[model samples]
Target: MEKCWDLNQLYLSFDDPQFSKDIKTLEKRLEDMKSIPCQDVHEDNLKSYLEQFNQFQDLVEKIYAFISLTMSSDTTNQDALKYSSVIETLLASFADTQARIDRWIGQFDLSQIQDSYIQEHMYVLQEIQENNHHLLSDEGEKVLAQMKTTGSSAWLKYKDQLISSMKVSMDGKDYPLTEVLNMAYSKDKDVRKKAYEAELAAYSQVEQGVASALNAIKGEAITVTQLRGYDSVLQRTLIDSRMSQKTLDVLLETMKKALPIFERYYRLKAEHLGYFQGLPWYELYAPVVESHESYPFEKGSQFVIEQFYSFSKHLGDYAKKAVEQHWIDIYPRVGKVGGAFCHNLHCIGESRFLLNYGNEFGDTVTLGHELGHGFHGECLNQQTALNADYPMPIAETASTFCETIIKNAALKSADSTQKLFILENELCDCAQVIVDIYSRFLFESRLIERRQKGPLSVEEIKDLMLEAQKEAYGQGLDHRYLHPYMWTWKPHYYEADYAFYNFPYAFGLLLAKGLYALYQQQGPSFSEIYEKFLSLTGQMSLEDVGKSVGIDLQDAHFWQNSIDMIKDDIDLFEELLKQNS
Candidate 1:
């Protein structure tokens, strides 16, 4: 009857004997790596060095993943926080020690190291070479590592604290911002509007602290990018993401062109919701027609598994296993987080799902979505630890693809009323991921540009947000109901770890659609291709990775094909609206 997940499956606790032993072993191995003298490292020593480095990296990844995943599930865990901080300190020390070796390695002739493992380690060697200029002497790197604890990292934590403690009151009841915000999905229109207003108003209380955090994080990020000889923050992110701005540029262009198609869907929604001018922001999520049905846990579980089996027996079987093995934590309770997520326990080759299942038709789809993510990781479990983590674009591909299977199945099975609701949910999510996300991309691009001139004021940020909404939304949302507090609550804006984090979503959605389209054409044969594309995402360049499935990333046509698929949906949505209106 546990409503939330139990991490004892991953570790009894961070202080568990096994976890403690791993931490000790990890530290000792890192120190051992650092003990190798710079002069002693040569081409002949390459094999030994790699064997040691891989072991150290593997352990570090395992330990960090365990602690971080635990904290995300329940950030209130003090032991998890302590472990994260301790591991971070360990990583910095490891990096500092490796810096000395890297500098020496950079000076050595890499051609002399002929082993395939050494050759593949070129990425590490290349990174060291690229960073050699900014890397201070070993002593300086060690010292800077200490300063960063109080620098950008501290600012990030402070911002997290500021937001987490925020409260908003509505109709004389004080509620956490998360709870108040969830009211937007209520069946009552008045509640959604009032919640929207309160949510916007509550943001002003912490605007200054949040703005300061954005400034500190991005400011340090910009400085570090320049200091490390990066062309820009965008470039650094792409390098880390294994994606290119060129691919993103193609994706953005496709997004711009696809807006009008979505505008039509919004127009239809406005007509349905009784909007005279346009659909209001609060009403963007308004219920047009209800599916008016619910599925209890057992039946809902069977439906998803049964529908998924039609696509491929492998996928269906996987969903069956997820439900049967108690891999999912279903049902909502107080103190549990609001959103659903799927965390892959790669070491054990399983996944844990956290859901606030309400037995609504939408809840069934949410189950489908998270289970889809679990299957994505299941596909990856066969990969080496290093290859299991994919970049952002492909990360959502499998999940979204799985969702499509469930939704499409429901689409075919439902009565017209139910079908309308199911399709509206799909279209609404698509619209947000496409249209609203496009607006965010525009806002962040201009924000970064403006931030370079000086720190943006609260007024200026609002103005920028509104401008982006106008362009992306066009005639869809009423000017009177736009959300300017968007940048305030979206955690993506504050993290300099990735800039322009908006477009990967549009990329993933469109890419998945295109992939889904191919699957529809080829039938069961497409699953093999889909699985191959997913497998290659970790090691290959975005374009090269895509090429495995015959996708050309730089070509606007590939994106256009995906955009056209959505337009087809927009047309169907309008046709259905007419039938029901």
Candidate 2:
């Protein structure tokens, strides 16, 4: 019944005594961690360090999540902002200590470590050893970490502030930018066009500032990656993502080949909508078939629970618990960030989700997607803190897998008109993941290439975006109506550490589709294998994760098969549209 999530599980308030105590504890642990002797590589010493590190991580994650979740729902919360900066500074100060520990661990061959405790964490320890190859000198590591607190971190916060506070004016009234963006799905053509125009106009007020933030963050990423001996930012991202270059190349090549199929779906939608040139960007999310049914929060949540139940009891139970436990922040408000995300708090064995719900069927699908992320977290609960952190590419597996479950279930029960709406919505999402995401990958690749030369101006950034759109979308989008200011608002580009966040969504979608195919072939028994795959994600390479469930990520055929599934959906969508017409 509560619209807002209950943060009482984290803390009653920032001023809660437990919150203060945890901060002090985190500071104390940092000191203890710094005192660990790097010269001693014995099993006992390593075990002790691991114990202390896990404890320190637990305290830090608790404090950080409380502050971040607080700030996410209300960016103006000054206390949350202050504490966030404090926690970041503390973590940055520990970079030298971490670097020393990593270097020390790197010296030992895992086969030589005989202790059971150390062996239990062999995978993560091996990862640390591998990552040590990229570490700078201790002082350099510390300096970079400390500098980033003021550098990329500050810019990211500023960007969030600018976007969160921005308002779009239309029809003599001002609306939160998120509310207007959600209007893209409005059944009324005028509403969609007006919202799109107003949304674009509103960015001008913040475009220059957002552009500056983008340049600073990206420039920092380029410099840092080069310093770490990475050939390019994308290389560093692949290493951090626990993915290989070959895997990425195959995935992208497959998606690139499938782009024409997506473009065809786009052009067909345009024809249905009476746009002869191409689908206007504003009309991208417009509903073609009218559905009398509405998906208010209660109805949507119930639907998600039911559909998840159809998959497995464990998944069904997780959704029910998330809804009943007040773990979701469920509406758009002035200071709330746009879009949706599921933050899995391994420290508390729970996950928190944020959504901008608007009672549309698309919103229901988004709910299913985020809840899928939560289920992934649920599976990882058995692992220790460090072992629970999975790579970005594999991160979307459970969420997108959950999305497939919800969509398939809905399609089976819908009338012909509703089927068209559902099928079209699914195609639109797939296109965004496959087609729009490719455009983003191109834009960011080019953006980084140019940022290395110098900071890109606002106009130059917009031009790069348009160029990428033209190339990726081809004739699928109207050139005149393309969204030029897209870079200004997408939160993905602003994160200095996580460059190339676009491709992972495509990776996840295709991988999930592959896994979903396995589920179809294996039936109810496949649930165990799926859970096992999700559980191992945090501890294994993505290729290994796929292989755990009999899937090969590096093979071109695996990715191509996934794309063909989307192609099948396009065929069904076309047939449904014809029947409706």
Candidate 3:
């Protein structure tokens, strides 16, 4: 019943004696890692280095997750802020050592290694060897790391503070920006319109500051990627994501071909909402059908747990444990970050979720999504720290898969109106992931391209966002009412290392849909295979991971099949809308 998560498992506080001891332990591990001979390629040295690296990563992750999570829920937590910087500095100091070790490992014929432990980590070793092709010199890598602590990293922190502290002025009152944004789903037309206007107006106060941060972070990304010999920021991201450019091209091509189908769904919703021109930006999440059901935290948690259990006991039990153990920090409050994210703390074999729950059916689905991420982490608990880090594209697969489970289950039990509501919700989410995400991809691509020339002014950034929205949404959104300040609030663009973070959501959704289709065909037996797929996510290439489940990542037909699944939902939603009318 607690609204806040317990971080006691990581550490009681920054001042906890164990926290200090761990910091000391981290330093000792760094020293031990530095001692590994860079010239040696023997099994003993390789094994020792891998073990030390894993232990070092585990220590850092444990410390950083606690600090970052604290800051996420309470951005003003000064201790968390301070320790965040301190830890980054320490990690930055390790860059030269890491570069040296990576260079040494890059020299080995990893296939020839016979040790079981090394073989267990062959994929990670292969990645290291591959990425080493772009590795900067030890000193150069160290300098970039040190500079980022003050450059993109500091700008990212500032951007978060600006957004988290922002308040939207509504009818004679101020609300947290997140609370106001969530009002987009309100059934009350006046409330949704006013909240949308207020939210847009509120961004002006921080728009310049946020714009500067974006330019700096993205400018840093451009410089770094160019220095590392990447052709573009997107290329660097694909490499880091362990995805092939061919796969991205095919996925994107399929999405472009399917955009008109989504646009049709949007236009239908607009007509249902009494807007003939197009769906107004504010009405994008508007509920088309009335739903009397209310889902408070407890009810929503139980609903997700039950639905998950319907899939598999292990998954259901994981959700139950997350809720019972206070793994979720629910509800919106001033200083808490907007949006929902599940942070998998592999170091502790647990995950924590942050959600601005508003008691809508959408919020319940969001809970299922985050818990699905937790379940994925649960399946990966047996892997070592180094081997547990999956790529970004695969990151959303489990979460979206869980989301599908929740929506489909709810649809089966709902009355006509409720089914319409649930189906509309699913379609709305898909449109965002596919349609809106495509806009984001375009905006970021253009932004990075422009940022390379110089810093973009606030107006320029807004213009870029609007241009991208128009192109992607086409006739789907009312051009006059489009959200121009989107680039200011989305955290995706500000991360220097994780450029082009938009398409992965689309990837996850389509892939999850494909996997769900497989589950539906195979019945109960597929649960074991699903878990095995999730378990191997950290240890294999994404293509190979898909192969494990009989899904081919490189095939255009596979992605097109997933898009068709959404098209089917759009068809059902259109039918339901006509019946309800």
lDDT, candidate 2, 1-581, per-residue tens:
88889889889998899999989888889998888888877878888888888777777878899999999999899999899879877887788988988999887778988888788788899989888878999999989987888899999989989997999999999998878987998889999999999999999899999999999999999999989988999999999999999999999999999999988999999999999998999989988889877899999999999988888999999999999999999999988987899999888899999999989888899999999999999998888877888998888889899999988988998999999988988888899999999999999999999998999899999999999999999899999999999898788999999899999999999999999999899898889999999999988888898899888888999999999999999999889889998
Ordered from best to worst lDDT, the candidate numbers read: 3, 2, 1
In candidate 3 the C-alpha lDDT for residue 314 amounts to 94
For model 2, the stretches where C-alpha displacement exceeds 4 angstroms are 73-75, 161-176, 201-206, 331-338
Compared with the true structure, model 3 gives a TM-score of: 0.94
CA shift of 119, model 2, Å = 1.5
Of 1 and 3, the candidate ahead on lDDT is: 3
Using lDDT as the measure, the top candidate is 3
TM-score of model 1 (CA atoms) = 0.92
Clashing pairs in 1: none
Pick out the ten consecutive residues of candidate 2 with the lowest summed lDDT: 52-61
